[model samples]
Target: MTASTLMIQGTSSGAGKTTLVTALCRILSDEGYKVAPFKSQNMSSYSYVGEKFEISRAQAIQAIAARTEITPMINPILLKPLGNYNSHVFVKGISYGKMHAQDYYKKFALYKGLTESKNSLDHLLQTNDIVILEGAGSPAEINLQQYDIANMKMAEYCKAPVILVTDIDKGGSFASIVGTLTLLEKRHQKFIKGFVINKFRGDVTILYPSYSVLKKKTGKPVFGTIPLIDFDIPDEDSLHSNPKQISWSTKYLNVLDKEINHLSKIVEKNLDMKKIRGLLH
Candidate 1:
């Protein structure tokens, strides 16, 4: 069988998608799976060492999680979009020079070559049991949605299952998760196996109500609510640096539980609480 892929995405930017993907890479690796990580396109200033070509720092982090060396093929297209519609594209981690948005669109055929390159690399790395794919920013941005070579489009290309991840700290995370589920085309939504609520604070008991509501609203399983981890992971987005700023507090747990219970009364439920408990453990 071919390696399975899980695409981690979020409702908006700075939703901790990258960090969670990296963590999952680490978790799966610990389980003795030969894992690899891939991102169709990444926009970051950080760089990583590669045997034949350079790789994105984000992929490098995942590589570290997998205890493997960085490979350029893991991140095929690296777009550094400065102001304007122009961005620098990297093919196989080597600078392919720059192109304006219009120029790039005009030459969209070139992306197929990059995609093929990634497929060839995946074939060569047949030792991997799983390949975790990371999606770009919110897949809901309609303006850029069609031109999207990442996220859902990338999943379609690679034929991978998707795991939509949203940040609960963002207040409207429920809406964002539901909106993303509803807005995606049928094909894309079919590939989505479950949803994860990230950056959760307070007690899990308190969060269960909202989780149940979201599950009922979207008809998707709540894979887990990743509590705010204090690891010093680098921030890929231009957001707050300290994750510790929004962790569970003893005083707030009771109120949070009450709120969740109240919400649960109004919405339906369909989450595997046992699986969620396993994730926490």
Candidate 2:
């Protein structure tokens, strides 16, 4: 059976896209659905060397969350920045050599890689009950819109419902969400199923007015508000530069259990998963 798909695109990097994807993967796995995670292209310094090739460590962690083996197909193209804005690109777990930013963007590299990414996604859809796609960054970057394989283009290709996630902690969450929606093509806007306010702290009730206004303005429901969870999870780049964050403490373990459980409950209580499921219907 062909799998149902969902794509999560954030307003910015570190908007909690990876964490939410990981949580959703675990939740779906717990519910007995065969779930897999996919990100067409990732630019990260931190990577996982799989059986044959290396992929982003974030995707590797996501696979674990889904109870699956690490595979480079999940992250088809990895761009490891090598300073001076140059990147050593890896395609399908094989090194494709290094190139400067202008050279990489100006050539056929992105398009060529899209073919492999699409093939990998097709393989994933055929093998799983559901595929959760995580886009690299905001879809609103008009400069990169045409060449985008990670955001709305990929969502359209998969016919997946999109969840626009914005980090409220970063402030201007409203403007970010609204501006992003405004910038998307009319057709792309229609693909959005809901908005997710992530990395939030303080009293959510205080923001109820803004939330209502956002829903009214965008004509999309607020999916949920995920609080600022200070649990240790490996982010793609942070995993390498800040190895200290990876350590686990029994003291922190109790906190992690409490926070994760609360986060799951928040997802269950605040987000309309039934509505999300209905998007595929």
Candidate 3:
């Protein structure tokens, strides 16, 4: 049986996309589904597995979610740009070495062979369950939109349904979600099964009206508004990398407060204070 895949994309980066995908992978695996995570092309300096295996640290975290060993096939064709249009390409976790964007595009067909190889690797791993694919930044980049093997095109390739995620904490989340849906090609919209509003704070009741409007506008189901969680997962995006250095804006401070309060209640009931205090310090 072919493996069913789902692409979790965001309005933009740092929209809690990686966290949601990891949580879903864990939840599904707990429900007895054999799952794997895939990313078409990842461009991050904070990588795991080094120059040997070109996958992102985020994909490695997904491997952990699946309770499986990390493999390069899960994230093939990683590009680490070192200024200019030049970048170092890693194929299956090993450095295939560096090339400029124009040069790479000119020889782009060669990467298709790599993608096919990765697909073959995925086929070997599929034991009749699911594979969750995470997409790169906004699928709206008009310039790079055509060469989007990371988000929409990857979903089309794998025949996976897409679940677009937008961060409400970003203020224009409703517009971002609706606009993304509207901007997608008619064919791509068909694969967009649902949309999610993430990192919501305060009463979810208050957000229902906004959510309703978005649903009506896009004609897509709102999966659920995911409350912001305080759990410390590794940062995959630079935006959230330096938590200590970056003070939360007033808006996000409220989001953090709500998340902290929620977690405190849970910890008060289930966790030992002394043990938790040690980790906190």
- Model 2 lDDT per residue over 121-170, tens place: 99899899889999988899999887788898789889999998888888
Q: Supply candidate 3's per-residue lDDT for 182.
A: 72
Candidate 3 — which pairs collide?
52-93, 52-94, 53-93, 54-93
Off by over 4 Å in 1: 113-121, 238-281
Error of 1 at 132 (Å): 0.5
Q: What TM-score against the true fold does each predicted structure earn? A: 0.79, 0.90, 0.80
Best-to-worst ranking by TM-score: 2, 3, 1
Which residue runs does candidate 3 get wrong by more than 4 Å?
50-52, 109-128, 240-281
Question: lDDT per residue, candidate 3, 1-281, as tens digits?
Answer: 66767778888988867876776666556667787877868887767764445477778767766766678777877787787989888777878778888777667624663465457446634653777888889877777677677788777776777778888887998888877877878898887777777777888789778767876777776776677666745576557555332232566545543443444343233223233122210
Lowest lDDT block of 10, candidate 1: 262-271
Candidate 1 lDDT by residue in tens digits, 1-281: 57766677778888867776676666666668787878877776556645567656677767666666577767877776675988777777787887788877557524663465457446624657777788888888887777677687767766776778788887888888888888888878887777877777788788778777877777778777676655544467446443222223555534433433333222112234344223321
lDDT of each: 0.67, 0.81, 0.69
Output the lDDT of residue 1, model 1.
50
RMSD of each: 9.3, 3.3, 9.4
Q: Which ten residues in a row have the lowest lDDT in candidate 2?
A: 238-247
Residue clash pairs of candidate 2: none
lDDT, residue 184, candidate 3: 79
